[model samples]
Target: MGNIKKKKMIFLIMLFIAIFMIILAIISPLLISHDPLVTDFENVLQKPCSEYPFGTDQVGRCIYSRVIYGARVSLGTTFLLLSIVFISGLIIGTIAGMSGGIIDTIIMRIADAVLSFPDIVFAIAIVGILGPGMKNTLLALSVIWWTKYARLTRVLVMAVKDKEYIHAATMIGASNIKIITHYIFPNIISPLIVQLALDIGGMMLALAGLSFLGLGVQPPTPEWGNMLNEGRSYIQTAPWLLIYPGAAIFIVVAVFNTLGDSVRNLLDPKHI
Candidate 1:
């Protein structure tokens, strides 16, 4: 009970932080101390003050504003990536799992081959081949990330395929498409939702890691990953730059993870 309550509290806190980050992203222009592009040669490396709560970056861009805007990119990428993965995974996994025999073997094997490579390696290789840009990052992320959903969906669909409703639907002369869509799809949705929440957090971290390495968001984009990359040189002299962006990544990831855990618990039949 204590652990459950703790998870709930953590999830709530994370939700609030995520919501605040979204709000900050939307109002960043008005809230930032100065234009994110404007450089004050004299104000370089100034510590956080009443005027600059998060201080200024090496280039004099407001750290607070950059962090806020970074949230926009990270969160936006998470949503886009998750949507593409979920939809594609659901369709592919469902078809492959329900079909069985040669089709199932072929699809699962192909998915396994894709999943064999390390996710970051696959992302970097794809992004490098596609060249640098946000679009490349999206392409990189989406290409490799879908396998998890596909594999999970396949298993869930297979397990539910033999259930009474699915069998009844098949016996009642329902077409394969109708049975899969109407009966099988609905039962697996809860698990899929939980997986999505967890995947979002994982993807956010991957995006940030890619950005920090220059394969994700490019410089001057005010993205959290880019900000961290820019701040690396100043780690010794100015740690706030790293701290602020890092915190933004940490908080958002934590929120998604917490939310995922809570949903998983709620959905578990034994727990309920």
Candidate 2:
């Protein structure tokens, strides 16, 4: 009982943090300093003070501004990535599961083949091929991320399709598309939600990783990962540079993971 209560408290804290991060992301543009890209050589490497709460970067760009803007980038990419992956996954997974037999085997095997690749490596290859910048990142994420969703949803669809209601729908001469859209998807929505929520954290981490590797958000763009990358060289002289951005990434990912877990538990109470 004590453990349960503690877990609940932790979950709530995480949920609050997630909400806070989201709010920060939404209001980033208004909250940040004038033009995150604008450099002030005089203020370079300034410590946290009344004027710049988070301090200034090595190049005199406001840390506070960059972080707020980076929150926007992080959250925006998460949403866009999930949207693309979710729709593609649902369609492919639904078709594969509902069709079954050779079709199922073929689709699942393809997904398995894709999944066999190390995620970061696969993303890097795709991004490298597509060249750098936001479009390439999105393209890379969409290409690789869909496989997990497809696999999970395919399995889920298979399980849900076997249930009595699905059988009843089939017996009533419902078309495969209708049966799937009306039955399988609704039943599996909970898991999909959980998957999406969890994937947000992973996606954010991936985005940051890509930026750190010089393949994601370009410099002067005020992205969290890029900011961290800029800070790496200055770690010996200005540890705060790395600390703030790194902390942002960690906290946001932790929040998403916690929220995902809470939602999963709530949706599947039997598991809890």
Best by lDDT: 2
> Global lDDT of each model?
0.83, 0.85
21-77 per-residue lDDT for model 1 (tens digits): 778766666776567767887888889998778999887778887787677777887
The TM-score leader among the candidates is: 2
Residue runs of model 2 more than 4 Å from their true location after superposition: 1-13
Model 2, poorest ten-residue lDDT window? 263-272
Task: Tell me each candidate's TM-score.
Answer: 0.89, 0.91
Backbone steric clashes in candidate 2, count: 0
lDDT of 1 at 146: 76
